[model samples]
Target chain A: MRDSRGMRAFFQVGGIVFALALTTVVLVASKAPPFAAYLNIALGAFGSWEVFSNVLVSWVPLLLATSGLLLTFTVGLWNIGIEGQITFGAIFATWAMRSLQGGGTDPAFVIMLSILAGALGGILWAMLAGALKTFGGVNEIFGGLGLNFVATAVNLWLIFGPWKRPGIASMSGTVPFDKALWLPTLTAQSRLSPSSIAIAVAGIVLVYVLISGTHFGLRLKAVGRNPRAAYLLGIPTWQYMMTSFAICGAFAGLAGAIQVTAVYHRLIPSISSGYGYLGMMVAMLVNYRAALAAPVALFFAALNVGSIQLPIVLKLDSSLAGVLQGTLVLFVLLAQGAREFFARKGGKR
Target chain B: MRKINRFILVLFLAAVSTVAFGQSSNFTFGLLMVGPYNDHGWSQANYDATQYVVAKTPGTQMIYLDKVNPADRPGTTASQLAESLVAKGAKLVIFSSDDMSDEAVKFAQAHPDIFVIMSSGDQVWKDGKNAKNIPNMVNIMGRMEYGKMIAGVAAAITTQTGQIAYLGPLANDETRRLASSVYLGAKYAWTKYLNRDISKLKFKVTWIGYWFNIPGVTSDPTQVADDFFNSGYDVVVSGIDTTEAVTEAVKYAAQGKRVWAIPYDYVDAIKEGNAVSLGVPYFNWGPAYVSAIKSAMTGKWTSHFEWNGPDWKNINNPDTSAVGFNRGSVLSKPAAAGVDKFIAELSKGLNLWKGPIVLQDGTTYLKDGVAATDQQIWYLPQLLQGIEGQSVSK
Candidate 1:
């Protein structure tokens, strides 16, 4: 067991080294100073208090999405429709705020109710994907993918149609909410909201405790390992899967809610900002371990916030961040596969 | 002891160099473009204007990040990106798109010390509808109405089928007014220049819902241009920021369709359409940008709105004009002469926006013989009576 543990650490470190080497090659091919580029990303992310705050602002949504994805991954389900779930959450949050604003309700209470509505919206959308997978024999991957397109279409329709700004039909999105409806931030100018960070941290801790320290978590692991055996063992398989989906959806909805109430303060067309997809990557990179989710998601968010400097300082495309992220995930998965392959060979011998 | 002494010496030298270099008088301005810098349209015009500033002004440099829209730069806002530019030592930041109006206002409010120029926005105009008293923000826009009018005259003279199409961007006060300006120019050219019957002229507008194409969101501009040319409209005047109309017209003309296109927003746009091009009505942002940057540098930055018009003395003068029109190669000899004559009339104070104009909903926009005020033209509420399009966003 000790040897195997050592081997796992060796392989993980090896994966990281390989990813770095490959990224270096890419930088060299592009004729950029690799060290300078890396330095720029680091500085862009943590160079100053203002940019670091921006990283935290990005981290809340990403961490929330990853925490939710962890639940789905634990149940052996791919919630690819998390993007749609996030979009629907923002849409519902926008709807709640629009419906309740200036209607004589306390703004704080309206914000709370809107966030709850966002969670409900995500729950409904996720349940649709879960139901499609369970009842209609459709795969969750395809169902979720189809739902993402529908969600985007719905978002575009609202932005350009009924909810459009008066006398304007552009993709600039709905009019911003009143300042009174905004989530209180660390500063008047900063988008970082303490309440949002608290919510995200609470969400991940809840997910961690639920996934690691409960009988329900064991049953979820069993369902994930083998649904048929779990079913025979009297664990309600489809119900567990649907419950996991609902839990993940709630987390995603909260992320969307924070985005509306704190970050953008309005529903733009790209409100989801691809956090659902990025969260999936973070979950995969951490092997779905909830403990590592926060740090890894923060790292990814740093990469995103940092890469903006590539264009401004280095004249390089910011998509290099995506390239690094893709290679890191790819190398780690390859290392895992290699480890498993070698272990199987040893057992046969 | 020796190593510590050397480290202290190095640190002292670094501090001295930092202070020395910081004392040099250098002005760094930042630009945030809504589209690709090389798009050869609205964004490119602004990018070139900054380049001009860098060239003409001593001790000045520019740093810019193009494609600053949310779709392109995911997980970021325009104001947040402006802060990044500020981190790079930019004292003044230019938000170079109408779409960035909200974020520009936010950035200006947040950074009261940083001078901000929000191009094509009326937020700083005290008399404008959405006016805000942003003390550090200035609004600058070219009067593209006259350029569009020239494009209309070019289309009116070149169209053999008597039907013209206006490829519109989005429905707003700005777009409505610009589209209406085109119709007014076309009507004048059709009746006065060609001596044609008023009943024979047909001007229609088809808005693609955006300034440029976003697949699955906006209607395909190429398809819209094809629809116009495939039908009987011989000339398609583009109001969007890209050159799809000119490209499509070139495609149609290559197949012996005899279609022509008048592209907007870029001076060299006719080079794309070649013989099928009717001309381009482009904005020249250099003169205004240079002055704005100079003001910011000299601590003379005062917040105001400027709706700059073309230099009538030399409309296409790169250093002086805010707007100009370049005639294309496809225009016939007489048609080219007519465009020149129309320009001369405009230079001699002929007002196309004068008198007797009716709204699409049959309300009088301007009474008989009454010229429009700047506010009336800027805040035009609907398309004119003779134009065919939705005047308001539904």
Candidate 2:
């Protein structure tokens, strides 16, 4: 036990050091100024109120996706299908927006309907993985991956064949959603909004409560820690697992809807903006705690926001933040395992 | 244990030595690319041309970043790269993409003393707009639409159904006008030359929302092309980046049937997929880039919107563009001869906008014998006659 603990500590320290070394290697290999890039990231991400708003804009989707992931994570499920779920959410929102076009529909109703559609879209997608795991014995990771490809194909068919914008597919995205339906902007020019902030905060609180403050949370933890034990205790393990996935899927969907309603004002091809995977990173970095997720997500958001400045200030690649963030996460993982190693080493010594 | 320590020491030294050697300055000119230098479309061609220029010029070196997504590094702009290059003592710095527009402007604004060249920018024009041109900045773009029209002619001639589809990256005015010019060229080929009714020649256009494929979110031009070909359209034109159009056509070709494709901005795109390609409208960004850098070096850098293309006197002539066509595509003998005649007429100033032009919605764009101004052409938001599509007001 002492040897194993020592090895764990060694791993913890080694992982952090290795990640930092890897980051340095990346910077040197790319011939970029790592220090300047880091400085730019800091300034761009958190240097001012205006920049903080940019961080918030990036954080909204991240927090939402991560909060959803917290549910599945609590139950020991890895729902890698968040990206596809987000895409489906955006697609569903687009369909709702299209139907309401020229109907002079109430903007609030449109927003609510779109969000509902997104949740439904995500839940439906997650059900596929859930069914496969519960019935067919297929792995969720591979199932989610396959479903992602299918969602992409379906999105393509809808946009190209039936829903292609009037003349050409534009980089600007679906003919901008009706101005009336747009999520109210913070300023006339900025996409950041008060409602988005509220939504992000609420998503964190709600997920925290559902995952940690309720019996469901206890059941989830039990199921995750030992599914067979939970099943023996008369708990329906499959139901809880599937519900966790469905809940996670819904959160991811809400993220997509918020992206459309708030940031983009219309569905663009890449509106998900890799937020799903980034959210996964956020979830893991925070050790899957709903309470810890918001600040961590904000940290990552700041990194993303800061990266935009590097291109302007340093002409460095924006991926520098990715390198740094990857390093930080790797370090965090190392730090978590260090205590075990120290105790074991003390015993051995 | 002693041998292991020696081996480790030797390995560490080797790594350090190798890295030191890798930073050696061999070439003088440095290229700061915004995206991957090997995307096989926009940035790749620019990278290729830089290598070509370096190879031909001799004693010149080129360094670039390939597959550098905008999100890769935060808070950095093209100007920062320019400054970094300047600090490294590079003689010239070239900003490769238009997304670098704001960054380039900021960099040029800050570093007025440094030599800067921005590709596909309009800031170089408009007196007092640019700080780089206060002494050392120049802009380079292409008459991409000129080659696009040539590809259009090929599409019109090669199409078995006389129906052609232009897949664009955006619905912006630049994309719109190019698509319009292509249709105009096709219409000229089909009606005036082939003696077919203009109404019978079907043309449709769709944009691929952004510049690249966004996995799981929307339709890609490659998939869009597949849909178009499946819908009985024969000739496909792409106004987006990548060899997606050519690649998609090649897939269709493997079934022993041909669906001709016209590609934009790179000549090598046609070479990428041999089956259904009908050449490409290439951008010769090198000449303009060279001229800009030279101007900056000699202190003659001045801002002007330069739109130069094949000397037309010998368009098939390879003297001018780093962005022109390859030789001997599979146009019919008659079509080939017609193209030659058309080139001559173009050289003599055949305006595609010689109108009585009407938009798809039947709005009069220009009266007969009237030539639209560059601004008018550049900002054209509507489809021309023979295009069956709508422009949404939202």
Candidate 3:
């Protein structure tokens, strides 16, 4: 109990330091007056219902992708190909939606097929990494990274070649989806949809229960902590690792599906907004806790939503947001180390 | 249930300001830039234009977001970003990229009152009737590719080896057209003036698949130039948005080779003593942008699409698009004369798009006096038959 409490306290201090470091970087690199600019960011992100809605627009995908990442994290598998998985999901979902167009299929059924296709797309993408990791004796990271390049190539090809929109000279992109398929906007101004938000929230809850309260969760954690020991204890360690990766990929796919159906309503050259990477950041920042993923994801989402105002209101470079984000994550890591120093100092006292 | 209700309430509030924007004049312009304003490319040009409007115009303030990747493009819908600018008191919003077309169209569709000016988009005219061109949304693009053809003419005339190379960003029609224009210009110079057959000149196009660097992968276009130069190519042209090609030319020039370069977009890129650094096919977006904003401010928003180009009289003018040039530090009298003669020929009545066009694969794209189809130009995947080098197939 004391250990867990100490860890929690460590995280708390880490969060504060990370925030301060992020602010310091922004303060130094500000293009507009710093405080006023930050105020605009804050106001733009959460000062009104409008700003928060913007945050929600960014939040839904981050929540889904990060929560999905948490499952794989528990199993000690790093599925960096979440980016590719997200792309595949969007691609497959697009294919499914396009195929079902004008078929007179129920809209509800069409949506389900789209979501299911996204899951399948993610699974297929993740399984390649899994196969390379399990059978080919490659590390998951390298496998996932390779798969990412392949997915990018595939996506570009699709947009440029077969799925090229008629009469449009464009960067790689597919034809726009029907309006009936577009996820209705939550408000006149925002892209947030209730179904997307619900799906992400539900996914987080289900993943939370799966990773924290189930036998699979326990075995995955055991494998993550000590794969050799778990293997010796008759656990199918490889299967669990693959399973975690698949689950992570599926969650990423779900995020991608929502990006297409709810957010973009069309498959552009890049649909995965680096949400996969951002999710990885959130997972790392929370140390891969399922419960911690949502709040952390929301915080980053708020930052993203609010940062749009930074350039306009402050005239600061938008890259400042990236510097701040990198600082926050770095300081959080530093805070983890600082906690130990502070504890050692306190003990001596 | 209560939490969901609160979430819904917050979302509703977030949307209220977007709708409130159409009914008001006190608006903020949300400038969503795809790259850093300091990138010295398309984004920088837009940034300079935005700054120009801000400095010259009163009662108007602009909000800008830069380095927006394609993924972030949707979340910050052009409409919402524009509306946010509107809420912040900007009367006009400018999205600076052809990539922003879909977002711009969607935003323009949703917000009828907010004036939106999207750069390099062809859809504002094609889809105008469907989106119902509310006097508020307009599309403006410059025919910089024509300027590229002019630069191509200069490069071809000055080349000692007669073998030229083009380093393009993507294989899309825009890149293809730009490259095609250059090839046409080169062909014109080589055939009409230089007394060289097109079959002897080697014009190769290599696409690096992305605008800038991707982590862990080297995106040094200068190294790409080295590969071409080492292989005996003399003049190199760039079709990408970045100055990487010009930088490559500078490096190659410093290496004591007489290799020349012609760059695209923005002036002042030719400064590294590579006077063989021909000129830039730049888009001067300021005049049109200022005019559009003034139109919006005066409630005279129109739905016309303008494709401005280097008309000489209008080239350096505020709104008319112009290609800039620095003659050459090393240009010999003859080479300079050649450039002057070609620029005059182009300025007088030379149509680069004049038909009798064929693809690298020997397919006719245009017959004499026929305009190329939007499909042919938009989906140009290969180089013309006469150009050197192979279109990358990976």
Candidate 4:
């Protein structure tokens, strides 16, 4: 029944809630009319349907990246290069959109092909890191780090060199694609793109099934737990590791593609938008459990969406949201570590 | 005692009524900033200007949302943030920066009652490709090209290496025009006054592909500046928002490498670079902001693009005009005199636009003696000839 794990989860949730509540109270009490700013934040994020849709806009990428990171975490890998994979995915998607923009090609067909290209791009980057680790015996963390730099360089090169807007390029990023080529939105005025959200939702479910319901998932866990033993059992540890990376990359890349197609509609320098890194945090916060990643990501996204009220209502820095997030995560980790220490002590006694 | 108590109640009720009237008539002014308010650069200029206007105008309240980074990041979208300000009863909204163009357009269309002003943007200009300007939207920019030219002249006058470098941020029409103007000024002073062949002057520009060093996405401007000094380029002119040129110049100078720089935007940025800082052509956003605010308040607002230059009488004057260059402490007496003469000619209406201007791609942009229009200047498509940089050619 994993009763101990359940108890740990319970305490973790309790700790986060307490930390957040205390922080809000302190911050608000420090300011005049404590609940007003908090109220604004709540109303800002969930006050209306449109506001909630904005939260969903932030959700798709975080969920996609975190879900992918869970797969790698299951296989005992920290896929830190997810940012680069995301960038490459966007680059490929942008390339596809740029090429097929003017011709009489149906936008739907082009979008389909572009999404595939994005997945391929991500898969390629992920496999490169995997090959470096499996074949060359390099640590994945450092390898991923190096690849991240290379990917940024490549993104910059394209931005300034081949893909530069005619006459000028600014941080505003590439000129948006034609209205026809843009990913169609669900409603006319809202920023929420339905296709991307649908893909992300389906992605989380598929990942859950893949990890919990399949033999491949079991073998992946086995390899991660003890690669040497897994190899002795004829599970082909190298293949499993490579496949896990490939799957993770596919998801991260999909996140990048959605970010490009749905949100910005152009490859800005911030196309990765730190979601890959944030996803790492989200995964860790959920204790690498895939089921909890969505809720955690939603909470962070809401924190981000809601924090806008800080500057408008209270003249406070919007980064207070980031402070709340950091505090919550820190307290949660402390609670877990303390629980672990007592559990170990109790067993010895 | 009864009479005194009745008088106090009457006074209290009068005060309460006035407060109610004031609340109903309060003009809430909103400013949307893409960076920190006190950045001492681009965003600071707008913030200070907004404060200046609020102080001058009666019954006006001020609120701002800073670090509204982008759609992908957490926090808020520009449109939604603007909406929040409007919810707070903002009557007029100013979306600052080139990056906020799309947001400005969306907001202008969505909220017609709120007067919209987009600073350093050209999306409202008619001649631009895909011209879309709403009746309520107005675009304003400083004639900073003149300042860039002055900065270029300062660099040309200071360079001992005969090689000048421009540390540019992002590639855009605004950046291209600024960089090109600097190149033109440097080339002119070199050939006309310095008695050096314009061909002999080596001017090369390196772009960091963003307005600031965004770590992973953009090359560090400090490293880029260090490379310029390391490679024998003696004068570095900053074309980005950050003070990396002057700060890096100061760092290089501390290391005993002789270098000079000109920082853009804020007038006080010279303090950051000190010994290495030449003159800065600064923006005085106060005059424009105050005027625009008053216009909105008076119901006399109309949509029109305004690009201003410094008032020669007092370049640092806070109130009316003075939107241009303030010579820094580094200029030698003779160099300062030369810069003054340049400014004098500029004030009397110097026309760089009437040009035998050839673009970097070797296409003629302006026929000889034909002055370029405001729309033409707003939409420059490439770095001009004689400027060594990446040509953003179609």
Best by TM-score: 1
Q: Once model 1 is optimally superposed onto the true structure by TM-score, how far is the C-alpha of residue A333 displaced, in angstroms?
A: 2.2
Scanning candidate 2 chain B in windows of ten residues, the lowest lDDT window is B68-77
lDDT ranking from best candidate downward? 1, 4, 3, 2
Per-residue lDDT tens digits for candidate 1, residues B1-394, read: 9999997777666534432331244988899998888887899988999999999999887888988877777789999999988878788999999888888998999899999999999998988888999999989999999998888888898889999999999888899989988898899999999999977999999999788887766789999999999889999999898999999998988899888999888889889878888889999999999999899888888999999999999899999999999888778898888889988999999998988989999999889999999889998988999888888766
lDDT of 1 by residue, A1-349 (tens): 2239888888888888898899989988999767667777888899788899999999999999999999999999999999999989999999999999999999999999989888988888999999999999889999999998898889888988889887776678899999999998998878888999999999999999999999998899999999999999999999999999999999888888888888888898888889999999999999999999999999999999998888887778888999899999999989988888888888777
| C-alpha root-mean-square deviation, each candidate | 3.4, 8.7, 6.0, 5.7
Docking level of model 4: acceptable
What's the lDDT for all of these models? Answer: 0.89, 0.71, 0.73, 0.80
Task: For candidate 1, report its TM-score.
Answer: 0.94
Q: Native-contact fraction for each model?
A: 0.43, 0.15, 0.25, 0.47
- The order by descending TM-score is 1, 4, 3, 2
Give the C-alpha miss distance for residue A339 in model 3, angstroms.
4.3
Per-residue lDDT of A31-68 in model 3, one digit per residue for the tens? 34445555566777887887787788789888888987
* Candidate 1 local Cα displacement, residue B304, angstroms: 0.7
For every model shown, what is its TM-score relative to the native structure?
Answer: 0.94, 0.65, 0.87, 0.88
Winner on lDDT between 1 and 3 is 1
Please provide, for model 3 over B1-394, each residue's C-alpha lDDT reduced to its tens digit, 9 standing for 90 to 100: 9999997677656544433333443445657777677776778778878777766667556667676656444355555666666667665678787666677777777777667887776565653323344466787877765677777777778788978888877565567778877888788888888888777877888876555544433246767767878888888887666776667767777788878777666655565335557766676777777778877777777777776667665455554553444455666666667667776876786676657877788888779888665445545666777775554333
Worst 10 residues of 3 chain A by lDDT: A30-39
Residue A265 miss distance in model 4 (angstroms): 1.7
Better of 1 and 4 by DockQ: 1
Comparing chain B with the reference, what is the TM-score for each candidate? 0.93, 0.86, 0.82, 0.90
Candidate 4 lDDT tens digits, B209-245:
6677766566799999999999999889888877999
